[model samples]
Target: MPLKSIRVLDLTRLLPGPYCTMLLADFGAEVIKVEDPMMGDYARAYEPKTDEKSAFFHSLNRNKKSICLNLKSHEEKQYFLRLVEEADIVVESFRPGVMEKLGLDYQILRDINPGLIYCSITGFGQTGPYKDKPGHDINYISYAGLLNLMGERDGKPVVPAAQIADIGGGALPAAIGILLALIERGKSGRGQFVDISMLDGVLSWLQILLPGYLTNHIEPERGKQTLSGGLACYEVYQTKDDRWLSVGALEPKFWSNFCKTIGKEEFIPKLGEPIDQQDVMKYEIQKVIRRKTLKDWLEAFADKDACVSPVHTLHEVIASPQVSARQMLQNIPQQTNSLQQPGIPIKLSETPGKIRSQAPEHGEHTKQILSQFGVKEK
Candidate 1:
């Protein structure tokens, strides 16, 4: 409801740009997705489909309109400019200079509407040596030195299950930048360019690791830091049933509480010992943890503040009590079946967001949108 009057013209496909606009659209902004007439969003063809619709596409593209337009064509490009005249934001995720080549970059858009917030979400950024380099989430994380600190002490870096670079680095930052730009526009009555690079985004999250290396000139080893895996107090231990339990009793008091609860009070003082000594302690803790099932540990620490929790699978996560209480899931009914989608996480007491509609089919609203803009599609 807060952004109900805002209009966004989204020219992004795949993950980052759509997700940024999806956040805006969920908050009651009018988002029109511009796609190529032939392919639309590339994610439409991705796997894990339900009733011929992409689950990945449906998750990021709800509460938005769609219109297929070939930016290469003179007529269609002119039509898009007409739409931009009334739009408050324009988001794109192409490689650098792609939009300029198509004559639809920010400079051209600003000529039509000077108050338009133009956001470019790219792999590197608009002005960098690697600006034109082709990359995905994994590549961005690797370049940012995040991948080096993710795996075991001597093992190779593992690909994360989460899209940290795409969603965290790219999408969320773009949304934040757009919001700040909008606020600034209200004061200055002028819009500016927002350049978001995924590499920069992923690297910015390395606050502790980067600072430690810079200050002490010591390279951090993987899985050897206090929080990564070196300490017995903060690590994942396997249960009797092969399920994992995350033990995060980092503080001395919590560590003592956990040790005493498990009838191992002697392990309390070894909380922040040296790395080799901590490994021995971790091995001992793992042996003790393996004696019980996850259910047993849950019951044992049910009333304690030891910061212990289960590492749930995808299915368990969806049915979790905390996720349910927070209302982080929604079921939207399609014509043939119901599609369960992720609910909006930004909860505002007065102006909460809603899933107004499902993702639009390719060019589903093309003619209607053109008609409303007084421009008939050729």
Candidate 2:
């Protein structure tokens, strides 16, 4: 494994920080998750717990050790500082000053270990006007102008099913920053701080839209553009059986072929016209799509040049032929028993990742982890 000896001290809970640590763990890093002694991660209490463990908690926290400690305690704080002295990375997701109040901020950690990569993930950032404001994934997306581009033309903005702001904007970028800092540390032999803001990540994802708004001075609206949902060439249409098919005939040639396939070749001339005219063509295409079942449409376009595909539900996605062939899903046995969990995502030929273990019980390895730091085992 690439990161076999790399040690990560995880002081994050819930989604973003745990997800980042999970990615590192999958690649064979030694991740020690530190949690509050009493409650642990709040996600542990989320509904549908099987044997006192939430699926959400289990899903994101595999292949890691858990240590429970009360940070407010002087003895526990000393133990935590000892752990930092030997760690390569320390990741936390508290609001700005929480760690400082606990006397475990980056400056203090660096004093213990100058080569430690201290990453802080938050809603806004470390030093912005909105840094102290309480916010979540939805709030970050809303502030970044991403929400305005979603949903129907005149309807309210619809929340996307995926946690784009949390995972994409926060976790993924934080992971990348940590990796890059590790690389730089090899050259300089010094570690630095990584401040990752979810709002910044979300806005970075909307860079393409930002340029258009700046260059053309046109404020984009909900479902009023090709990428949003206005164009007939790229949108979702409901079939007779109520299933939806995603039609992404964005290219000129694909659009022409799709129009001919649906017997709407006459409307090909207005493919990229004004929103009103495109809506008319969209209605015509929707009417044609509603006349056939999803299976019928799938079979009809099986050999065609059209770029159409059925929107898959979670179950269908897991059972998909492509997913199976790519080995995207794997069964990870439960830590206590032989039951399995979801497999790792990325595929590396030589050093592929595996789900070595399920999420640990709270404070399951507290004594062992503290022992590693030369603290007396409790």
Candidate RMSDs in order:
0.9, 1.4
Give the alpha carbon lDDT tens digit for every residue of 1-378 in model 1: 999999999999999999999999999999999999999999998999987989999989999999999999999998999999999999999999999999988999999999999999999998878998999999999999988889888899989998999999999999999999999999999999999999999989999899989899999989998878878899999999999999899998899889987888998888878999998988888899999999999999998888899999989989999999988989987879999988888999999999989999999999999899999866
Q: What is the TM-score of each candidate against the true structure?
A: 0.99, 0.97
Worst 10 residues of 1 by lDDT: 225-234
For 83-156, candidate 2 gives per-residue lDDT tens digits of: 89899999999999999999999999999999999999999989968999998889999999998888999899
TM for candidate 2 is 0.97
- What ranges in model 1 sit over 4 Å off? none
Sequence-dependent TM-score of model 1: 0.99
> Can you list the residue pairs that collide in candidate 2?
332-340, 332-341, 333-339, 334-339
List runs of model 2 lying over 4 Å from the truth: 335-342
